[model samples]
Target chain A: MHRIRCPFCGARDETEFAYRGDATKRRPPDDADEDAFFDYVYRRANPKDWHVEWWHHTGGCRRLVKVVRHTVTHEVHWTGWPDQPPSLPDGAP
Target chain B: MAITVRNGVACCLVLARRGFAEVTAERLELSLEPGRATIGAERCCLPIAPGEWLVLEQWRADGGLRMQLEGDAAGLAYVSDQSHGRQVIRVAGPAARDLLGRGCRLDLHPRKCRPGFCAATSIAEYACALVQVDAVPSFDLVVAAGYAESFWLWLTDHAAMFGYRAAIETVDRP
Candidate 1:
């Protein structure tokens, strides 16, 4: 089981958190075209290496946190608040 | 272990003003930090999340605590009475920590879970708030009313293994 470190609450079991989707997605502008909105909603990248995503500390602090995780290894490299960017180590996937 | 199911306690949910600290210090005289509770004689302030707290008190016939908090939180916070919506369970004994560690993922070792340590996490898959009460190694588990019965059943069933005695009392009794 993966242990996620919450920004407010300390590290807790993965069962306490809910996987929010990819954090890289940005919503299209309000006046953007319909195709742009459709693409923004439907399309997503399923990366294999290091990926940036959002995980909600549902059972703990109940806050949205950004996490950098490896898809294949299931290793969480970094975790922080949603406002902060993921800072990965050198040579990290 | 000894377990007491506290009944008729006054519970309040406090959401502090964003970007500033208020209500807790001015009204309750408790300073809140992340994952720590400030305990007073009759009151305990537990941090539920960022800028939020669950204030529990020993209820009296006059219902003064919630009323006073509502009045004091006019523009500072949003206070909701959770007296009937949540249940407080106190577990104490020499083996209290061991009993709780069964389902609690957070480290319950005395070295890490000293008095005033508090966290909002799940125990046995039920979301609840846990706070260390005193050196007796007592812990107060605040759970929602909806999950109280199931949580109690789970607690009692597991507690039986350690030979626990159950009682009913006020929040301050422990």
Candidate 2:
């Protein structure tokens, strides 16, 4: 099982966490067109390489954490608070 | 090992507001740092999260766990009595760590989780706040009241392999 290092609770089994989907989505402007809104709401990228995502430490601290992970290897590159910018790996896309 | 179901444990959930960590800690006389617990003669404080703690006290005729907490908080934090909403279980004796490690993910090695160290984690799929109370390696698991029976069943069932006896201890009010 993958171990996620929660910023507040340290490393714990992945069973203690709940995956919260992609963290790279950006909201369209308030007055943006319909297509922009549709893309923002429905479109998602399934990258095979490094990706930014959100995870909730539900069983531990119950905090939201932003994670940089390699989808192919299931390697967690880094984990930080939701308010902080993700520090991507050296060769991360 | 011996599994004791501790009843009547006076508990309180204290949540320090942002910027009130120091005041709360000072008033309660217990450090609220994560992974740490302050155990006194009759009182113990286990860290639950950043600025959050689960305070426990041995039940007494004049025990005012909530009153004492509310008084200490003195408008600096939020305090809620959990005496009736949670149950405390004590697992003591040799082989305690080995039995617990069967389901707990955190390394329960002596060097890693020494006495006074506590964690908010899960055991046997049930969320619990665990604290190592002494050098004997006795551990106190505070779990939701609703899950106490089921958790007890699981604990007793698994504890059979290591040879365990059931016991009860009292400490409670509302």
Candidate 3:
């Protein structure tokens, strides 16, 4: 069983949570073009190395949390709030 | 920081009931009961489909039993411990419907989320559980426990705005 650490509830089994997509998303500027807005809302780059993931703490806390996990190893790099940036690997591609 | 029991109304329940259990293709079976999950024969009888069973431990994935669970489990996919990390808020009374209107997006109708059904969704900007506790319009909100205090405040604050009054009530697993 995969045990995930909920930023609010400590380490818990994966079931008590919901897996949202990547946590890292660009915030379109107020005066950005339609294309930029569409990209921010739709397009995404699924990188392999240290990746940012969005998670919903469905078990207890309702706040959206961001976790940095390795896509391959599934090892958590770090977990933080949505505004926080995910930690990157050395010379990440 | 003070972990205030904000309202002296929360109740701890003796939730000793069988939730859900499953057996995987690996021939691994799992069960989520009240206290904890264990492989094979345990003292308490489970009125469930015959298979492997494990009680849902409302604690962290650590220590002896956890290790047993790790080894015995086909995977942690079957048993879930959604109780610990999240706050469970219960909002009852006639105005319960009105109170939930502000944040909940799912259909709050009784038939939609009837008894014995669980909805895993969000309310406003928070993760929440909407259960119809009473036949006569009472409902419960099982949310991330960490945000319990805030949601409680929000519920009451908006409840007042919605002409509804609420108090903390204890929630136990049965």
Best by lDDT: 2
Task: Tell me the whole-model lDDT of each prediction, alpha carbons only.
Answer: 0.85, 0.88, 0.51
Residue range A12-85, candidate 1, lDDT tens digits? 88999999888888899999999999888998888778889999998988899999988999899899998897
Q: Per-candidate DockQ versus the true complex?
A: 0.83, 0.72, 0.05
Error of 2 at B21 (Å): 2.3
Give the TM-score of each candidate: 0.92, 0.92, 0.40
CA lDDT, candidate 2, residue B135:
85
Each prediction's total of clashing residue pairs, residues at least 3 apart in sequence or on different chains, is 0, 3, 22
lDDT of 2 by residue, A1-93 (tens): 788888878888999889989998888899999999998888889999999999988888788889999999999989999889999888777
Candidate 3 chain B: 10-residue stretch with minimal lDDT: B1-10
Q: What TM-score, to 2 decimal places, does chain A of model 2 have?
A: 0.92
Q: What is the lDDT of residue A50 in candidate 1?
A: 86
Worst 10 residues of 1 chain B by lDDT: B19-28
lDDT of 1 at B164: 91
Shift in Å, residue B113, candidate 3: 3.0
Candidate 1 stretches with Cα past 4 Å from truth are: A91-93, B22-27, B61-63, B170-174
Indicate the DockQ of the complex predicted as candidate 1: 0.83
A-chain TM-score per prediction?
A: 0.92, 0.92, 0.81
Best by TM-score: 1
